[model samples]
Target chain A: MTTNSSDFGPTNPPASMNSVGPPAGVPDSAAFRSAGPPARMPDPAVVPPTGQSAGPGAESEPAVSLQGVTKRYGDKYAIRDMNLKLPRGRVVGVLGPNGSGKSTMFRMLMGLSRPDVGEVKVLGRNPGWEANGSIAYLPDRARWYADHTVMRAFTWAQSLLPGFNLDSALRLAKFMNIDLDMRASAMSRGQEARLMLILCIARSVPLFLLDEPFSGIDVMSRERIIEGLIEHMSESERTVLISTHEIQEAESLFDTVVFLQDGGVVLAGDADELRAEYGSMYATMQKLYRG
Target chain B: MTTNDWQVEPARPPGMFWALIRHDIKLRRRRGVVLPRRWRMAYAIAAFVILMVSVTLEGPKAHFYLNAVWYFTFGYPFMTLGISAGRIKREWRNGTSGWWMSLSMPRWQLVLAKAISSFIRALMIYAGTYLAVSILGAYTLVLRGTFNAQTMGQFLLQGLEWNGLLVGAAPFMIAFGVLLAILSSSSARPLAPLMWVVIGGLWWGIFPIAGASNWFAVHGSGQSAAITITPAVFPAIFGSWVLASICLFLSIYLMRRFVDISQA
Candidate 1:
């Protein structure tokens, strides 16, 4: 995952283009270092000193921000010098292959793991603080208590998560054709996947992180889940980050795309802009990775 | 939908703690590892049967049964270690802990809830067995016309002392078990039986090293020595309680900072 500074030289561009590499006009020595949130975008929640309104150019803050964040396990870096910003009210696809640190990045954002050297902020606060209430996460694997029936699982969620909408969850469950009385352990892998999706969608959080949500499910179920997700996206001013290898299937759902390789972003931009410049997401991704 | 529809209220810490405690209790019961209803019933029946047999064999010697009960109660630490260890290991093996970590609750709260719930569950089981034995002992004393106020008072006092010792030892045992499960490989096979053996061997070794092997044998004697609550025992009781608190604190600290959900 280590690369010489020269390799990242010209590949980095200015933030105006939502470039994947370093921001423009910085010395090569500090190119990789995160220059904190752009000067134009002052945080709205941070009150200006007495009798002062924020500048007119102040832009809405990102839903998630990672600055010079590096998470290491033993001697190996899981996430190395990563800097990313995900804007609100958009569906961002985090495209990566296996062992590309997708899960590690997600864990850091969820506050399950801490960065060794940098800062991770979710919804304007440190990850795992009050930001937790604003994020709904569905992990790659089923994590429910196997002994619990679907109804019991819902009950547990309702009790713990303040934003969990029981009525919505029940409706979603019915739509998915899942029995509330069925034990979680008794469900097949595909059924379990659907159940998890239903649970995540039922939460009314501002940020949603779906990690490998479509993995191992049948094509038909995947389509249904995708449709459900799209419906949810349309109804709310929410941000979503879907990490997946099923890029082809999920590309259309994304408003933005981030391509990760060797624990660092190789490419990132608005999906429509990338489509205009590079034809299609699949083609763009293929060219980028194959290059 | 209104703008308020999307607003997510912050989760109250106490609500989260209670929810986790309820979830853990349900989990333990379903897994049948800690104070399952069926096991409770089975234990009650066994206790009754033991009382009946002991009464028939040795009339008016019901106090003898107290010795057996005390020894059995003393072994609760070993039981606590096995059950708590198994419960934690199962959570890791099944990935429930990862789910728990994903929730919008503080890490310390989760650990504290589990520890409190597990300790209470173990206490309930020990209390049930102790109560049954005490009832039988009192009935036999009444039958023998030896149930005087002074004798009854002494019996109650001894019961309280024994309970204090057992309670003092419980937290450390359960906390250590939880710590081991949290630290060990999730894929490792069940270590409950092996843990029991190891704990038993360690206790045996400690008895000889502490020069308390004779005292241990005397404590187990049913009829030879009368149980007493004396000033001499207060230091050991205080030390045991202090040790328990330290283990519990360590368990919660490690769980908050070091537990790796990715492994689960």
Candidate 2:
């Protein structure tokens, strides 16, 4: 449980995939992986069986919702029958190993990619050009505009996007100790990540999707990014769906956690409840991967 | 879950058409040739001197020398097809296509920005190259004691007609290039080159119907090739604009539903 590597390093191997339903503690929703063909079994405890998920002081609308969504590329399924409803004004950590369809889910939510089947709604509407105003989406594997200075990039963003605040962005950059005159192509990966986070954080939007903001970042930059994120999230009524493999570092920020494997939800619940049930978010991850 | 599944992106530029123009300007030096700033200036100067000297010659020799410059002025848009395609492809090449797509603008607006920017870039290159060439050619004619004010005056009108034709054809060239770029990055890539020829081949059809060589010259061919501007120039330009609009419409339509930035 103490080890933080992506690998679980199982102590007790669970039953084989063919002989078992989900390994001892995993929810029935994980049956998609065990049954060969996907079967959606939204656990009543984690997934809202119908309508929007309601959190403490939650409004009528969920920040984002996906209903029986399945996206395929050629012959392979990137996401298969995924049903997710994230509550408004909550920090939901999307935890999964590589190839767990995490980025695919974010892309679908941002309307960059449409599902082959089912529906996805972001900020109470179908994700599209019109729905873009209420959501600040940070894509996985994004690079800064190679030719722009941080100031120019900010100016471009402020002009084009409806909710971006130029003062906040400049202040955020200063707070992160970055030089605005630096060209985007010359930025260190950590500085670029922090700058990107600032862009998302400064947007006056209700929903924020941050996909893998910590990979390859240095310790100091990660700490600053987390602090900046915490500062912004605490001050606003923002709903954020963040996907990260750095579970231990990001675990404290999650109000709820969803663990995915092979494009299906294997374990999900309130972060504190999961901590009490399985020891910690890390421990729950271990159990989910015990198979 | 894999590397492909994670999108911890840097900030995307805004989706406004002007935003792309600003970005393109920043990268202008880096496009095409990889020369240092001083070397690029030197090359332009050298080309200018050569064109000036060439214009001073008499007979077929002057025509032979100036033909390259004329072709560059008129043929300039053809060279930009790859450039226009490359401009769109650069987003994918830099792996920022998804970020560009996520910006809150319509897909057509994105493609339109590129088309317009490419057109502007083509015009800038044409203006710079020919302006210097024409000025220097006139200067050389003066130095040779054969500078004719009347020929020089007629050249201005010829220049406008040339500009008009280019202005008309530019949309089709740039729009088709954008279409080629999107299609080249798509599942329909195998058919792109063939599609380019069939659709863009319509550009040549106008030349035959309107009479290609009569009214189009950038102060050329000593005397024989230096024809005055014709009334047909207006119809020719109008025809090119029609074809260009069709290409732009096709590009916007395809970009909305078919073009996948991630694949780029």
Candidate 3:
């Protein structure tokens, strides 16, 4: 099943590809130096911004742009006439309560959902097949193939996703303490979460849309996942839009944060600015969500 | 990829469509459409026991009973329909459906591969059923000193001619099943199976109008009557092919326009 000449077995991959890995025997993930994004990480396919970014240095083309986008499922609307722009090369956190259309918005950005009105542009073109290559998506409530062990999952991704970095994936798996031979069905929830994150971050793609990566995991696993994210962030500059309810710990990861409520943005700005104005991101979100 | 891995030419790697087909086949080899593996296994064992008991007691009459396996082909189209919808539904239900939309191939190719995998699995089951029954029946007839190759061959050929209509209808059934899975809302999903029957019934309605009764009058009068077919089969199969094409087109359209296949 090995796709490449690399030592990783079970999945076949193209040639050699490396991910950002910390030095061996690092006790604390927080201390792991992010040597800056892996050189192979491609520039996010961001379209020239027609809308303005509210963040600093907004003049550079934004990675994602949505204009009056409305998506309805039957009688109810998922995202209603929403407009926003996300800057490239920053970690953006999408925070919202349950049913705030966070998942729907991600689906639209991935070209998995159609908008009833308005437009969505990712990396300069509409999402779907055209934008698929440049984006790595981790859908909400998604699990790995139940039949697949970590080794098989590596092979599955390598065979299907051309840019899949098997070497980094293997290293990440080791760092996460994930057993390569364990089937997804047999793994704990935390193990599965770590495995899924490795798959997304190991890719050489620019934009990452992660929905609920931390949902229903233990505190320890959450820290490990955060560590994985930090590793990815330090390795290279990439546009990552992560939506999660585990806001307290992940709040610090965001350079920019968008608060979604009832399918539209209630508040959005630079994370540091929002913190200065309202104290912690958790407090700001609680105020916005309750109010 | 090196050429030495496959039985085909090693120079060129498998194209996306072929690669997808290979992956899809591997996916379905273990996962059943409707039932769990235990139930399916129990079913096969039960069928084997019934066949063995019937052959032991009834001798050549078991061949007469096994002739009913031809009627099982009529069940193939519906089985194909279920497998087709199940394939798409599993991806959505599991949250591993990113590959479905993210692949840089044409939407039509995805639809075609979905149908092909389901069709292959259902056909394998369908053909396997007939193969088992026919082989056992043949052996029984030989043991009874009544194995008439020409006579049995003619009967089998006649059954093929009649059952061939279901084979023609299979494509339409498979395509419609896929469309129904995507077109229907989650709340409306419970009704999908009944919808298939109604749609399938409407397709079957054409046979009666095309003079199925007349063929029955001429060739289906008795057990020993000559099973001649009316010339309506070509038009029937042709009409189904046309409808199947239309279904595939509609499926492609839905993917490009309104349906977010994962949610759908």
Candidate 4:
């Protein structure tokens, strides 16, 4: 089967969206220049500053919506009926204690696991949008083949992902002090984590899902990684989801914090608003969780 | 991609699935890091010793190759199931399984790679054993007499029969290993290979028991132990292979469709 759109059929989406979703309005220049029938390509040209992207201050519909999405394993429930609405261009932090379903939410969002019940919609589609290069996900236990060097890993990722920008990834890797020639097996924990983060952040995509990026990192390494991620989010219209138990460190980076407890969303809102109303975001989350 | 000779379905075309498979293979190849040189050498030495012992002890007759090939088939499957399952467990212990499952890779691709990799290993073992047996048989013929058509025919039949048997059960064995990898935690993963070996021994034991009784004919227990080269043997072996393939495919499909990849 054709991994890309061109080989599939005439009805396939144009080459612009073939490997990666064109950010906003880049045309199918690749196909046009390659000498192909323009009519056969599904137009991946960005939706020009119009349609949903152009409303003034008006709210856009959520790219991801979940209602009562629950996952149960025999008696224990990972998540229960979690009602969540994620619009375009917003970083949603999934905050919860261990076993509170933060990871489960990420899994469901990535289509790794189906909820026992409820609905999940990502970018007006199911979770398998990686094929369209619209979503990028970095899970908690980020891993790399130990035999390959950082450069090899980067090349492999780029080959599989349409929007994976190798140059940006390499630059990010260097910025993080990761030695490109070092094999993955020999890299320190901090170095491997940095490499994985760099790869995910450098991808030219709209949705970036990061699970526990700051968890289990030394303060110095943690700050560097967080700062690098912040740079990635410099664009105004990209969405990021970071799940973490290190609330104190991650709280400052997120615009919205979603508090989950007992597999259900206990509270969710603007971080500043919640902190202002409840004193400290961390304390408020603890109190809410304890109760 | 054209519809002229290959288009059998109207839905999305076959390109999507082929792309999926190719994508999986490429990723797998890239990620297939060679083991440390020491590990590779150790395995190679072990395989050579086993082949040598089996050939030398069994002689150059049909009996020798049959036993040698059987052991060879069993060895590769056992090692592959053990090693692959162990790797999966290691990922679980290191907390990487969740990350891998979340990679947007279809679950079937994961299982497919595991099975296909094992199949490739099996072919290697098969080829090595075949070459060793052929050489030994040739040596024996030169010492005793000249090559005979009847003797060669018997040898071929025996080899084919063993092949059919190996192919038939290969799928279930691999599937069982994957199922264990999914169900068991890292600490418990090593037990899966042992479970398979025990089950295999029991499976063999049943044949002897069936042969000792006439009433057990309905169980079809004789096929497991019956080594005779007959027309019926090949068909029975092929039929069994077909059945195993279907079961393996279904097991893989169900796993891809429903298994909770989020679990540790």
Which one is best on lDDT?
Answer: 2
CAPRI quality level assigned to candidate 4 from its DockQ score: incorrect
| Candidate 3 C-alpha lDDT tens digits along A1-291 | 101113211133212122323221111122213323111111111222222232344434467888778887778878876767676766888888888789998888888787889889886677876576677788787777777899998877776664678899998898888999998877888999999889888877767889999999999999999988897666766678999977998998887777776777655666776677567889767655543
Clashing pairs in 2: A98-B1, A98-B2, A99-B1, A99-B2, A100-B1, A139-B7, A140-B6, A140-B7, A140-B8, A141-B7
Question: Scoring model 4 with DockQ, what do you get?
Answer: 0.13
Q: Tens-digit lDDT track for model 1 on B1-264?
A: 233333345444347778888777643433323464598899989987887887756756444544344555667777877666667677656655556777777766766676777787788877886786677667666877777776565566566667766776677777767656655633232543565576577678755643542322233344434464455455655665576566567656665666545644
Evaluated against the true structure, the overall lDDT of model 3 is 0.67
DockQ of each: 0.26, 0.30, 0.26, 0.13
**For residue A104, what is the lDDT in candidate 2?**
88
Ranking by TM-score: 2, 3, 1, 4
True contacts kept of 2: 0.34
Top-down lDDT ranking: 2, 3, 1, 4
Cα lDDT, model 1, residue A282: 84
Question: Which regions of candidate 1 deviate over 4 angstroms?
Answer: A1-60, A276-279, B1-14, B27-66, B131-164, B183-226, B229-231
| Candidate 2 Cα errors over 4 Å, as ranges | A1-59, B1-68, B203-225
* Docking outcome class, model 1: acceptable
Residue-wise C-alpha lDDT for candidate 1, range A42-159, written one tens digit per residue = 1111111111121221124566777777777767778777776665566788887776678888888887777888888886678873577778888766456777788987888788
lDDT of model 4 at residue B226?
30
Model 4: lDDT of residue A186:
86
A-chain TM-score per prediction? 0.79, 0.82, 0.79, 0.77
The per-residue C-alpha lDDT of model 4 at residue B91 equals: 55
